[model samples]
Target: MKAARFHAARDIRVEDVPAPGAPGPTQVLVKNQFCGICGTDLHEYLGGPIFIPTAPHSYTGGQVPQILGHEYSGVVEAVGSQVTSVKPGDRVSIQPMVSPRDDYYGRRGQYQLSEQLAIIGLSHPWGGMAEYSLVEDYNAIPMPDDLSTEHAALIEPTAVTVYATHRGGVKPGDSVLVAGAGPIGQLQVMAARAAGATRIFLVDLNDNRLEMAHRLVEGLITLNPGSTDVLREVRARTAGGVGVDVAFECVGAEAPLGLCLEAVRRQGVVVQVGMQGKPPALDGFTLTYKDVDLRGSWCYSTLMWPQVAALIASGQLPAEKVVTRHIALDDVVEQGFEALLDKAGTQLKILIEL
Candidate 1:
């Protein structure tokens, strides 16, 4: 099988590797159809060891030369003896997360928060950027025939945004602001609107992404904080100079994350959706005076995948709109990863079609 493996920073290779062996009693073998290159993958390719283990990971026990994809979809090629939920020929999306069953967080039903957490692609032997993958049965979520494999590849990231919106408590008629117009930020806009937020603002320094966000999301207002005063603009558009009801920081930077503190109305909520490279400073005065509720959202609950998949199936999520480019497995390093680093900021989601 041909797979893209990460050996070190700036070194991803497409090489012929051993295919994942037959499934274990509670496992399934998935033949890759479509795999999306995510921001986390970029981090690993650019400067990492962030999630890719330097030493062996405790949970998955996977080490370096790790496979490098997680947001993906495939067909069930085979199932293990104990697998009953899905069978051969079933199309599915992967949840990707893995953790030890006996871990404290796992026992509490918060497996994503487990200290020994290891994602399938980043820590396990098989990932979607390959010809085949071996995953636990619980990680495979069946997809309806009506759903395209392209859309199925987006379920993982979409689930993240759905969880973020839920965490922020977006309600009907609320005004929302997303402080980043990257792929996740765009999805945050849609998720907030789906949660019944009436007015949505997408803030970014890149004009290309802002334009794409405006086009992809209905009734979205774009702001370039680089040129415009984002805080003033948001307050002017919202009620009582109070600003948006909920603000999502999706850039994972100090500037954008800081904007969330100033952009939300008094008593409003701010959800941190993006993973920051370093700890961002918080404004104590703004947090104290406005009584703003700040919340951190990690990955989604195991139960959130079904809801996200249903949203994609229902045509409400418009996940396909976020796809800016598609490349073959062989071109993943150049066309897929490098293109996203283009200064134009034109690319959003880049999918590798296997």
Candidate 2:
């Protein structure tokens, strides 16, 4: 089998490797089809051992050179004796999160918050970038018959946006603002709209991304802070100059957080979806004076995957609309990762076809 393994920062190699063994009693072996490169993978490649363990991971007990991909979909090639939920030839999406069953958080149905949480590609021996990978049967979510394998690969990331929008308490007729127009930012708009938000506002410095957001999502008002007063523009566009009911910060930068605070109405909620490299100082006075509900959102719960898949099946979330490029596994490094890193701002959701 061919797999791309991460040896060190800036050192990912695609080489021939032994295929994974058959599934354990509770695991399933899947043949990879479509895998999406994630921002976390970029962070690992650029300057990590961040999540890719230098020593054995507490959960998966695996370390670098690790296979680097999490967002992916595949077809089940084989199933363990105990796996009855899905059979061979079933199309499924992989949920990479892993944790000990005995962990306090896992026991309480909050496994995503478990202390020993480790991801498949970053910590386990198998990952979707390879020709075949193995995962616990519990993580193999069946895709609806209506969805193509390419679209199923989007469920993981789509779950993230769905959970974030839910965290913001997006209700019908609510007005919302999403900061940044990256892939996650673009999905944030759709998620917010699906949650029944009538008016959506998006902010980004890049006109191309803002334009892309407008094109992909109907009724989205886009503004580039570099050229206009984003806060003032949002206020004028929204009713009564009171600002949006909810604000989302999808760009993990200092400025976007402040803009989220400025764009949200009094007593409204602000959800932080993007992971910042460094902590940004908060304006204590502003938060206190407005009585705003500022919150942090992390990874989605395991239950969110099915809901997101159903949303995609129902056409509420057209995940493929954001896909700008697709490349073979052999060209993942140059055509997928490097292209995303380029400042030309021409790509989104680059899928690696195995």
Candidate 3:
């Protein structure tokens, strides 16, 4: 099978590799259909061995040279005897988390936070970029026939946005301020709208991204923070000298993180949805005096996958329109990597169709 394997920074190459070994008792073999390139993948490819705790020899799954995709959908080609949730020929979206189902976290329904967690494609034997991927039955969520593989591939990332929005507790009448308009940020806006945010303010330096955000959602007021003072504008627009009810920080950079803290109302919720390369300074004085609630969110749970899938299928959430471009597996370099890196905020989601 031909898989795009990451060797070093700016050094991903497609290589012919052996197919996945036979499924384990709880495993299922899925024929790859669609995979989404993620920001973490970009970070790893640009400058990383990334995070492989056990190494020396590495892997596409459960190891390094990691096939490196967590967002994807595939068809079940076969399954081991113990796989009862999905049978041969079933269409499923991969959840990608490896956790003991009977463990304390699993029993308490927070398996995403379990100590034994290992993500597929990141730490497994095979990933969706290859012809087939090996995943445990528990990681396979059956996507409905109404959902396309393109949309099914979205469940993973959309799940992240959904979880973050839910964590922020955006209510129907609340106002939201989103710090970035990247793919995740756009999804975060959509999730905020669904959760009942009446007004949304998106701040990004790029006009292209702000325009995309304006066209994507109705009644979203955007700001080019490069030209205007976003904090000043937000304060002027909202009642009192303070800002929005909820502020979602979607860019990991220092400026955006700082602005998120400055833009929210006193005692408002601020969820840090982005991963920063370096730690940004916190406003200890503001937190001490103003009582701002700062929270960090990670990836979503299995329970949220079904809801994300339903949102996409129902078209209440415009995940499909967010796809800026689609490329074949062979052209991932030109269409996926360089274009994304070079253009940055200009493009939204880029898809790899199998």
Candidate 1 local lDDT, residue 300: 92
Better of 1 and 2 by lDDT: 1
Tell me, what's the RMSD of every candidate? 1.0, 1.0, 2.0
Q: In model 2, where do residues sit more than 4 Å from their true spots?
A: none
lDDT of 3: 0.82
Residue 325 C-alpha lDDT in model 1? 90
Question: What C-alpha lDDT do the candidate models reach, one value each?
Answer: 0.89, 0.89, 0.82
Write one digit per residue (lDDT tens) for candidate 1, span 1-354.
999999999999999999988899999999999999989999998998788888888768787899889999999999999999999999999989987777788788888888888898898877899999999998999987778888999999999999999999999999999988888999888888888998899999999888888766678899998899988889898989889999999988988878998999899999999999998888899899999999999979876777898898897888888999989999998898899988899899999999
Residue runs of model 1 more than 4 Å from their true location after superposition: none
In candidate 1, which residue pairs get closer than 3 Å at backbone N, Cα or C atoms, i.e. clash? Answer: none
Give, for candidate 3, the lowest lDDT window spanning 10 residues. Answer: 52-61
lDDT of 2 by residue, 241-330 (tens): 999999999988888998888788899899999998899988878888889999899979987877898898888988877899989888
**Worst ten in a row by lDDT for model 1:** 210-219
Better of 1 and 3 by TM-score: 1
